[model samples]
Target chain A: MRTIKLTLNGTSVSREIEDNRLLVEFLREDMKLTGTKESCGVGVCGACTVLLDGTPISACLALAVHADGRAVTTIEGIADGDRLHPLQESFLRHGGFQCGICTPGQILAAKALLDANPHPTRAEIQHWMMGNLCRCTGYYKIIESIAAAAGAE
Target chain B: MVPFTYLEPASLDEALALLAEHGEDAKLIAGGTGLVNLMKQRLVRPDFVIGLRAIRALAGISEKDGLRIGALATIQSLEVSELVRRHAPLLAEACGHVATVRVRSMATLGGAMAHGDPNLDTPPALIAMDGQIVARTRRGERTIPVDRFFTGYFGTVLERDEIVTELLIPKQPAGSGTAFLKFLPATQDDYATVSVATRIALGADGTIREARVALGAAAMVPVRARMVEAALSGKASDEKTLGDAAPLVVDAIDPIADFRGSAEYKREMAVVHVRRALVEAAAKAKEAR
Candidate 1:
């Protein structure tokens, strides 16, 4: 076991976790931050996408110890108090999700994209969000949502 | 994943000492995009997991006579680095096409090399550019040419105590043009059915002065198309010259049949892609000249 101190969702937190604990397991199981989902445990599916130092990474592929002294942003941290983040609002406004399983990852991944390029083109959005799979096949809506969010900003 | 003790070494010396002490019992973890998955599948169960992220020395991209890419540098960093794009545009192009933005953000070039996965896009690009893998151990440092670095599937010539420190990629010759083509019949992010990277340098007279060709996901290891390169040497960069030489790649590759393609299908695709890559690179070389 090792003690890792990191800033999670803008709040400083310290925890003693198993060395083998993955970032996804640490968030969902230990910290109760279930907003991050793990699908296709391999890095291909971006269901467990989270922002590490403002960059999107597969939480399932990252160990909690790797988060030490780093900043991690998850879907639970996307909202401003009770008000949903613009991306979240845009997703709902544009019917961006169907089953909602991949919604958190999609939003977080989109958040990282918009943070890097505020005004991404349709092609840019597709390229960035291509890794975050939506089995519900609501991709057109997701694209629209991200575009709308970019425009809203 | 099975339980294992995690060790974080803040310096290269400390990391090397840890490796030398643990020997084969310890596994190095950088970014974890490749190693974590293998551990989850129970393919690699190291008693000690050494985290290399804390070592500040093994990060960043710098240019001297050639590019010095630190092992801890993320693939995303290389994809966006102006120096990388300006000096080795083919490498930047290949890095951009690795998995996705997220994987690129976490996968390091050194980690990718150490992982020794033949299906990866960067190795062929590295091979084409004459990149070298710089490894360090308690004994000393040695440079292994990228083409000869990988011994077999998911294997490298690295010893138990050796750690890849950086990738040294020599700048391409003047009037040289390169192309990286990944044949992805499936999803855009999927590994290539057959990937080819070619570098062609032209003389002032527009004759091919030098040529380098390499392929990934086409063989057990990334194959350097020496025959194709030999065939193109001193020849005019024309369609027929490239066409005749493209088929010579079959002698170097032994692809495995998988869901992406049959071995026969990949061989055929390899020839086709090699021709296309060569043609594109030749055009670029002419423009460069």
Candidate 2:
């Protein structure tokens, strides 16, 4: 076991986690921050995407111990109290999701993209969000949502 | 994942000491993109998992005599690095092609080399550029040419107590041009059906001064197409010359039949892609000249 202190969302938290515990498990099981989903245990799918030090990474492939002394942002951290983040609002406004299993990850991944490039083009949005799979939306709506979010910003 | 005591070493010396102490019982974890998946699959069950992220010294890209890339530098960082793009754009292009942005953010270049996956895009680029793997043990350090770094599938010559410290890529010749082509018939992120990286340098006389050809996903180990390189050296930088040399690549690669392609199909694709890469590289070389 190891004690890892990290900035989650905006608040700092310390926890004693198993050495083998993945970042996804730490967020969902221990912290009850189930906003990050783990659909593909491998790194191929971005369902478990979370921002580590302001960069998106596969939580399932990242160990909790690696989060030590770093900042991690998840989907739960996206909203501002009652007010939803612009990306979240844009997703809703554009009908970005269908089944919604990939919504959280999609939002977080898009959040990272906008944070890096506030005004990404349609091609840029497609390239960045390609890893976050949405079986229902066929990706056009997701692209629309992200582009709308970028424009709104 | 099997339970293991995680060790975080803050310094390279400490990490080397830990490796020496644990020997075969310990496994080093870098970006965790590769090692973590192996652990989850129960392919590796190390008693002690050494975390290398804490060693801040082993991170960053710097240009000395050549480009010196620290092992801990993330693929994303390398892809965006101005120095990398300016000096070795083929490497930057290869780094950008890996998996996705998320994987690139977490996967380290050193970890990629140590993982020794034959299908990875970086190895061929490294080999074509004459990159060297700088590995270190408690005793000393040694440089292994990237082309000879991988021993077999998922294997390298790294010792049980050794760690890859950095990758050293020498400067390309003045009239050199390089190309990295990955044939992905499936998803953009999927491993290549046949990947080719080629570097062509033209002499002032317009003959091929030197040539380097390397391939990935075309063999159990990243193949350095020495035969193809030999065929191109001193030859005219023309379509026919490149076409003749490209077929010689078939003698170097022994691809396995899988969902990506049949062995024979991969061989054919290898020849075609190598020729295309050569042609593109030759055009760039002419422009550079």
Candidate 3:
């Protein structure tokens, strides 16, 4: 086991975790932040996407110990207490999800894209969100959500 | 994943000490995007995982006589690095297409090369650019040419006690152009069915002065199509010549039948992509002149 200290959801979190524990497990089981889902643990599906130091990374493949002294922002951290983030509101407004299992990852990945390129073109949005697969929505609404959020932000 | 002792060394000396102590029992993990997945599948079970993430010296992009890409530099950094874009755009383009944004943010260039996966996108690009892998151990430092790095499937010349520290890619010569072409029949993020990377240096006379052609997913390792290169050198970069030279790649590659395609189909596609890559690179070389 190893002890790691990290800023999670804008709060510093220090915890003891097994060396093999994945960041997804640390966020869901240990920190009780089940907002991040691990549908495809192999990093192909971006269902476990989270912001590490403001960059999108696969939490499933990352070891919790590797998150030491870093900042992690999950789906749970995006809203401002009773108020939804622009991305969350945009996603909801645009009906960006049907199954909703892939919504968190889609929003997080979109957030990273907009953070890096605020005014990305539709092509850029498609290119960036290619990894976050949403079988139900057909990805049109997700793209609209990101584009809308980009304008609002 | 199987339980293992995690050791994060603060310095290169400490990491080398741990490797020297554990030897074959230790696995050096950078980014952990590749090694961890293998561990999860029970494909690789190491008693000790030496995390290289803490070694801050192993992450940066610098250029002198050539480009020095730190071993821990993420693929996403390479994709956006202006230095890499100016020096080696082929690498940047290849890195941009690897897996996805999230995976690229966590996958390191050195880790990708050390992983020695034939389906990977960077190996052919690096091999075509004549890159070198720098490895270090308590014994000393050694440089292995990227062309000679991979030994077999999921294998390299690296010893258990040695760790890859950086990748040194020399600047391209004048009048040289490079192209990396990947044939992804499925999703955008899927591994290429057959990928080709070509570097063509044109002479003042408009003939191919020198050529390097490498293919990914062609064999157990990234195949340097030397026969194709030899056939094109000193020849005019024209349609007939390329058509003749393209078929020679089949002689150099031994592809396996997988879900991507049959071995026979891949060999045929290799010829097509090699031809296209060489043609595109030749055009760029002409433009550079």
Q: B244 in model 2: Cα distance from truth in Å?
A: 1.6
Q: How many residue pairs clash in each candidate?
A: 0, 0, 0
- Candidate 1 regions off by >4 Å? none
| Stretches > 4 Å off in candidate 2 | none
Q: Residues B114-176, candidate 2, lDDT per residue (tens digit)?
A: 999999999999999999999999999999999989999998999999999999999899899
Write down the lDDT of every candidate, Cα atoms only. Answer: 0.94, 0.93, 0.92
Worst window of 10 by summed lDDT in candidate 1 chain B? B52-61
* Residue range B88-188, candidate 1, lDDT tens digits: 99999999889988999999999999998999999999999999999999999999999999999998999999999999999789999999999999999
DockQ of 1: 0.90
* lDDT of each residue in B36-128, candidate 3, tens digit only: 999999999999999999898788999988799999999999999999999999899889889899889999999998899998999999999
Tally clashing residue pairs in candidate 1: 0
Error of 2 at A36 (Å): 1.0
Pick the winner on lDDT between candidates 1 and 3.
Answer: 1
Q: Candidate 3: where are CA atoms >4 Å away?
A: none
